[model samples]
Target: MIRYPAYAKVNIFLKITGMRGDYHTLSSRFMRVKNLFDTLWFEPKSTPEFEIRGNFDCDVRSNTIYKAYKHLLAATRSDKLSEWMETHAVCVDKRIPSFAGLGGGSSDAATFLRMCNERLELGLGVEELAEIGANVGADVPFFVYGYESANVTGIGEVVERFDEPLLDFEVVTPQIQISTPAVYRYYREHLYAPIGAEETARLESTPSRTILASMTPTEANDLYGAALGCYRELNEKEGWFFSGSGSSFFRIKDEE
Candidate 1:
């Protein structure tokens, strides 16, 4: 049996660039926080099966971990590999909160892919694993590569690593859960904007610290307006900004 830690991420800066078909394109800076994570345990079994046990409230089969396993299993497509792969069971000890914009689900899926590749000796490299991860979810590739910080763009397919100090931050989730799709739908209907090259370049050139320090209500998240409509208290909080399409908001604080 092997255990893996699937960490949580915070979007330091997120901007909607445009729309690609039905999907929204974005340019964002992502940072992984070490203090928050989900723990997954994988043990070999004679038959392929998945079990999730934790504070999570979701169907076991519907979990991203299981989907990742199935996706990778199909990718191999060898009778021998399939048979060998089927004889495995995964137990997830989830800690990260869902729908909080922490990328908890994506992290779980990506970690499972890496664990399976190593345990099954699939010989898939980081790039191959990231490709498989991307198919599972947009944010999965980020966790698959396991970068501490990255500038992610192109609807999350493009990732560029950069140097940044690990941050100490606080995250708070409201009782209310906001749907990501709902937020995007609201954005498209009410607040869609075409981000020009100049704006994109300015955002890219701005240092992380500068962005964090200057995070006005308007600049924190492009989806803020939609989220505020759904959760009015979000507007009442000081120093808190929505994380992703969020019900959870966070603020960077000084390290003790």
Candidate 2:
């Protein structure tokens, strides 16, 4: 039996530069959690199977672990594994909330890919696993890199691993709600002054080392304004900041 903790993550900084024909161009920094996570258990079986347990309020058929397994099986041509009555049972303890833009789904998918590769001794490289992961979700590749911090871009497929591990941080999610699709749609219609070209230039010019040093909890979430506009609960919160596109918010902690 193999049990792994599926850590949650927060975007330290997020910037939407532009939109492509099929993808959104973004610049962002991410940090992972140590205490909070979804739990996954892979138990040996005679056939390939998946079962999710916990408080997740989402469709099980479209779950990340299932998708990851399907994608991996296709890429590896391990039809034999599939032919078996079952070789493994994936059980997920869903601690992370769904549709909160917490990347719970993506993290689950990444963890599935990693565990399968190790269990089957597929020996797939990081790039190979990430490629499979990208097919599963835009954010799955980050977990594959196994870094505490990373500069992520390219449909969330291309990851530039950071040299330094991120400083200690804490993340807290508010009780409000925001729809990611609604926020983007609203922004497209209103067009509230794109993320200031000057601000982007200044941010891009700052040395990576300095940027990490100067960053604060308040400046942590770039989706603050848009999320707050969508959900009023944020304005009342003192330290909470939005994560990803909406709903959930976070704060950076002082310890590692």
Candidate 3:
């Protein structure tokens, strides 16, 4: 029998820097939180079945946890990777609020991948694990690599270690949920714009810190306008910022 503690994370800062032919280019900061998590328990089984139990409303098999396990089995070709991996019960002690845009689901999937790799002795390298994680979801790679802080980019695969001190922040979410695919669809259908090569190059050249330093608190969240258009309640908040093309709006207040 095996159990894993899946942690949750919050994006300290998130920006869509540019869009690539295959994926979007991004620049953001990430922090693991002590507050929210989900648990995954696995044991030997005759056939593969994933059971999810907790606050999550999504289907178990479709959830990243199951997909992550399947990906490992395919990559490592280990029988235990498939055998014990079969019919696992996910007793998700979910504390991270759903639709809060806190990367809770992605973190859970990453934690599962890390623990399963260890239990099954897959000997998969970080990059290989990250690649497998990417197939599971865009943000899973970040949790697999577990860092205090990072400058993440390139569909959340390219993570650069951050040397700056960790910033303390508080996150707030309204009673709304914005699906990632839905947000992307809205952008494509209504707000698509041609790549602004000059602007993108300029944005990339300046350090993210430098850019962030110049912005006022109220001016954060570039996606707020589009997100509000999707969910009209966003306009009621005076100084809220959208967290990752989300219906979740937040304001960062330093911990005193």
Candidate 4:
């Protein structure tokens, strides 16, 4: 049985650059939450079909892991992947909170794709895997690259590794409900004022710690306003930096 970790992540800073079709383009720093992650592995099962044992609230069709499987299969057209699944079942030990702006689902999907590539000897490079992961979800590409810190841009299809100390973060997710689509929709309709390109370049180049100290929660994350607009309960994020879309917030560990 091969076990792997699907790590959680926090957007140290998320700034919307523009829009491509209905999706919002962004240039943001994605830092892996090293301490928090979900575990995945393949266990022996005689089940004659694809089996995923997990705490997922959604069904197979909506599951990101399943979607990854389908995409991988489609991309490779390899019978080995299907044949291997027939003997072993996929199991996920989930710890990351779903819909909490932690990239739990995307991480899981990306991890699955990586696992397949490694185990099957698919000969797919990092870039190839990232490309495949983009089909799964926007966030999956970042996880596919498996970087400690990266600048994700261009609707999340572009990921560039950023050099920085992996600072520990204090992550919190409030029970208030929020969706990425809902937040973007509200932002587009009610509050859509994008920052200038010159400012965006400056923010992306600045260190995350400095930004955390200088910028307020609203200033750090462009989606925070829309999040507040969509869910009135999320009015003030207690002046902490907001993560992607909504509901979760984080700060450097032990920083005042």
lDDT on C-alpha atoms for all candidate structures = 0.79, 0.69, 0.65, 0.87
lDDT of 4 by residue, 8-49 (tens): 998888887778888888889998999889999988898777
Error of 1 at 210 (Å): 1.9
Sorted by lDDT (best first), the order is 4, 1, 2, 3
Candidate 3 lDDT for residue 187: 58
Worst-scoring 10-residue span by lDDT in model 4: 232-241
Instruction: lDDT for model 4, please.
Output: 0.87
The residue ranges of model 4 lying beyond 4 angstroms of the native Cα positions read none
| Runs in model 3 lying further than 4 Å from the true structure | 1-4, 43-48, 188-219, 252-256
lDDT of 3 by residue, 26-80 (tens): 6666656554566666543445555555676777777777788788778878876
Q: Rank the candidates by TM-score, best first.
A: 4, 1, 2, 3
The predicted structure with the larger lDDT, 1 or 3, is: 1
Total backbone clashes of candidate 3, pairs 3 or more residues apart or in separate chains: 1
Candidate 1 per-residue lDDT, tens place, 15-110, comes to 998988988999888888788898887556665544555566778767887688778877876464556545656667778888888999999999
Superior candidate under TM-score, 1 versus 2: 1
Identify the superior model by TM-score, candidate 2 or candidate 4: 4
Pairs clashing within candidate 2: 46-86, 47-85, 47-86, 47-87, 48-86, 48-87, 169-253, 170-253
How far is 147's C-alpha from truth in model 4 (Å)?
A: 0.5
